[model samples]
Each structure stands twice: as structure tokens, then as C-alpha cells.
Target: MTAALPRADVAPVAPAKRRRHALGWLAVVPLLVFTAIAFGLPALAVLDGAFTAKDPATGATSYTTGNLTTSLQGPYLTALLGSVKLSAVSAALGALLGLPLAQAVVGSRSRALREAVLTASGVLANFGGVPLAFAFVATLGNAGVLTVRLGLKDSGWDLYSFWGLVLVYLYFLIPLMVLTITPALEGLRSQWREAALNNGATGAQYWRHVALHVLAPSLLGGLVLLFGSAFAAYATAAAMVGSAVPLVTLQIADALSGNVLVGQENVALALSLDMVLVAGLVMAVYLPLQRRSARWLDA
Candidate 1:
């Protein structure tokens, strides 16, 4: 017998799938356009300015690495280091506090409690920028009501310093972490706990030996989110402390606004590039961990 001919349905399957995939991408065309316009264009502009140097007298433009070199030298490097330090510490503390709080909320039987906590977290997480700065300044800054009444300033509490910024950052960062890890906390299957208990494991043992292993990726991902959130923070830091703290965001602002040094705008752009690279690194680590967590959680 001659070799059987392929069925009509089978022959058309690949093209039909390709068409569906094309339609899927087409559906997201608007979003892709928006992203290009909003993010991609600005990024390109920053990248160009970061490497382009302008001559003052001749009004000439040329590509150079001087801006990048300047950004990595002197106080700029200090500010970058300070920003990384602040983001790391804030993210760590936020994760520590948020994970437990999320766990408590998730483990509770009261749906109302869980709803209330999540609602509050969602609000507080977004409650940053200038308004947040003002709130903290009023509550903890020098001559603040609480500061005076509670004698916190006399106790050496300064809300315009590095540690103080860390505290302010934590206000929102903790809530953000809670929101991020809540789903991961919920993704934790009850069966795992049951199985652990059935195997004569204690609560702490179950977590240390079983639950923590599974939650590790999600936890790290949430920490990355918090780090990025804090790293890119500007308004709150700028308003609260100005240049009192050596933060890269403040350095960028000062450079752009000519508040620190005039005609260092290119350096500001280079700093922006640096921040972008750091953020890219954070995302690279986060995306893979998130994918792994999702796979395990879904399975």
C-alpha cells in the first residue's frame, strides 16, 4: 500500500496554531506600543545622553565615556553605594517583618481579618513619595509633635539621616513585601503541612525542613521587588533629607536640577544608566526565581 496521506486536520494544525499565536501578539499590540512610547523611548533618550557630550562654546556633540567615568567616581559612587546599602537593608527588614505578618494573616481562619490586612497593605504599599515624606517628617522630624513629646530627638532619633530613611522606607516597603508574598504564602498547599505533621514534624520543623524550602524562591523574589522599590525611590528621599543622605536618586535629582553641579546633566544620565543596570540585574534574578516559584506552586 502507498504511504498514507496526512489527514487534513493534521496538515492544518501548525498553521492554525501559528495564526492563534499571531492573534495573541496582535491583541497585545496596544500594550507594546504604550510600553515603547512610555518606557522604551525615555530609556533610549537616557542611554544617548549618558554617552553624548556637548561642547559649551562650539555647541558640538560627541560620544564619550567621560560621563560614565564621572558617575563612577567621587561622591557619585558614594551615593550609588549608599543607595544600594539602603535598598538592601530596607528590603531585608521588610522581608523579615512582612513574611511573618503575611504568614499570620494567611494562617488565620478569619476571612475578614485577611481581607482587612490585604486591603491595608495594598493602600500602605502605594502610600509613598512626597506625602509619605511629609507624614514622617511631621511625626518624627525635628520639632515634630511626636518627636518633641516623645523625646525621640533627645534620644538621637533623626529622621533626615540614613537610618531614618531606612525607617521611612520600611513603612511602605513592609506593606509592599506583604502584598507581594501574600499570594506565595497562599500558594503554599495545605497538604504539605498536613503531610509534614503526619510525619511527626513540629510547626517550626515543618517550616524549616519543608515549607521554607518551597517558599525560598518567592521570598527572594519579594525581596527583589522591595529592593527595586527602594532603589528607585526619589521624591520621599529628596523631600525628607535633600542631600543629607548620600543616595543615588538624590544625586540624580541634584545633577538634573543643577542644584549640586551645573552642566553635569550628562553625568546624571550616566547615573540613570547605572541605576537601570542595577535594576536590570535585580529583574534578572527576580524573574527566574518567580518562574520557579510559580511552577512549584502551580504544580
Candidate 2:
């Protein structure tokens, strides 16, 4: 009788917990496979190609620093500079525009205005490539309706110029910056503002002492993201300005699609090298921003 009672007191296995554990890992399996096949393999290919170069005379592929060095020469350098400059300007403009808009959105008493701002931001954030290009062209291009309506001479403005590219890039970039930075701004509590006010601090002083400290890291991160987005953009520039602007992405696309550099693997290698250098620049910006973000969050 005692042995039978002991047997009845034994713990039952948790089938539900086991089933949940199995399902969780099963869900992860597809994602793991997708990452390996899609992102991992291509990334490996790029890494391999970046290091190895084909011999022009023998048509044999081998590793060489020369190809990478040649890749860093004049054209790539010019394009890299242009791309960086364009992206930096776009990010700066976006931040400037975003800050005020974010402030308004966060500070607004009207629910309608906040909803409208959010909706507008969503639409504009996804507005890129050909459609954005055409939007800019329509507003600023020679034959555009706005241009015709304004009766401004074609010589008064050129939407295909480098400045024009900056403007067009900013159109989409500003909304993204707002979306990115607004969360950080809105996350900040009203207590900080009230405390600062109670301490006899001016509005500017409060912003500088409290708000800026809290938001600086996130702002920097958003700038990095924006800069990267604009730097990597190809279609907007191509559709609006063409290769006449001399961006690194344009160079790569030209190598792959058009004359002089078409089907040239070496040039592609060079283009990849150019891309690496730009990537380095982006990382340089991003690392410091991340460090700053960590510090702010810790504080």
C-alpha cells in the first residue's frame, strides 16, 4: 500500500511546456535558413570578391592589393566624396526640418494635427526612387508644371543639379528623420521640462541642459541612418540627374549596365572597393554615435 501511494505521488511531465519549446525552435529554423541562404551567402561572396582579383592577361583569378588600390583611384575618390557630401547635407537638412516638426508634433494639443503629421510622415518616408524623382522633377524641372506655372526661366533653376539632388533626397529624408527622432523626443517626460522651469532656467537653457543631453545620442544615430540611406540611394539620383552627377552608386550601375565599364569584373572589383571605403566612413560615423547613444541611455 505504501509503495502504491508513493507511485501515485510521482511528478507528471509537462507536455505543454515541451510542445511550446519545440514550436519556438521550429519557428526559428526557417529564419535561420533564410538568413544563411539569402544574407550570409551573398555577404561571403562580396567578401571574397573584394579580396580576389582576376588577372587581365591570363584570365586567372588571384588575390592582389593592386586591384583594391586601383579601385581607390580618382573616379572612385570623386564619387565617394560626392556621395558623402550629398548624404551628409541631406541628413543635416532632414535633422533641421525634423526637429521643429517633431517638436510641433510632440507639443501639439490637437489630436487631428498629430494624426495628420504621423500619416504624412508615413507616406513621405516610403516615398523614394522614381516617384520621388518625378515629384522633384515636377516641382523643379524645366518642363514641370510648377516650373511652367511659376513662369521662372529654366535657367533660374535646375532640378538635375547636385543641389537639386540634395533637395530631392531631403524630401524623403526629413520624414524619416522625424519618424526616427520623434520617438526619442516623445519618450522624454514632461517632468524634466517642469523641473527645469522650476529651477529658473530659460527655455533655451532647459533645452540645452536637459532635452539636448537626452536626445543628442538618438539624434546622432538618426543622422547616421539618414546619411547611409542617402549614400546608398541610386534610383532617385539616376532618374532625376543621371550619371552626370558622378555618384559612386551611379559608377557601379554604369559598370554593370552601360558602356566603357560594362561587364568588366575588374571595374566591379574597383567599385566594390569604393563601396568599402564609403562603408568605412559610415562606420566611422556610426561607431561614435553608438557610443554616445549608450552613454546617454546610461545617464
Clashes of 2: 0
* Stretches > 4 Å off in candidate 2: 1-26, 280-299
Candidate 2 C-alpha lDDT tens digits along 182-273: 77777787888999999999999999999998888788888888888888898899898887797888877766665555345556656766
What number of clashing residue pairs does each candidate have, in the order they appear? 0, 0
The CA lDDT at 223 in model 2 is 89
Cα lDDT tens digits, model 1, 1-299, are 89988887788889999999999999999999999999999999999999999999999999999999999999999999999999999999999999999999999999999999999999999999999999998999898889999999889899989899999999999999989999998998889999999999999999999889999999999999999999999999988999889999889988999997889999999999999999999999999999999998999
The true-versus-predicted C-alpha distance at residue 14 of model 1, in Å, is 5.0
TM-score for every candidate vs. truth?
0.95, 0.84
Instruction: Assess the local accuracy of residue 45 in candidate 2 as a C-alpha lDDT between 0 and 100.
Output: 74
For model 1 the local lDDT of residue 258 reads: 96
RMSD of each: 1.7, 4.3
Point out where model 1 deviates above 4 Å.
1-15
Candidate of highest lDDT: 1
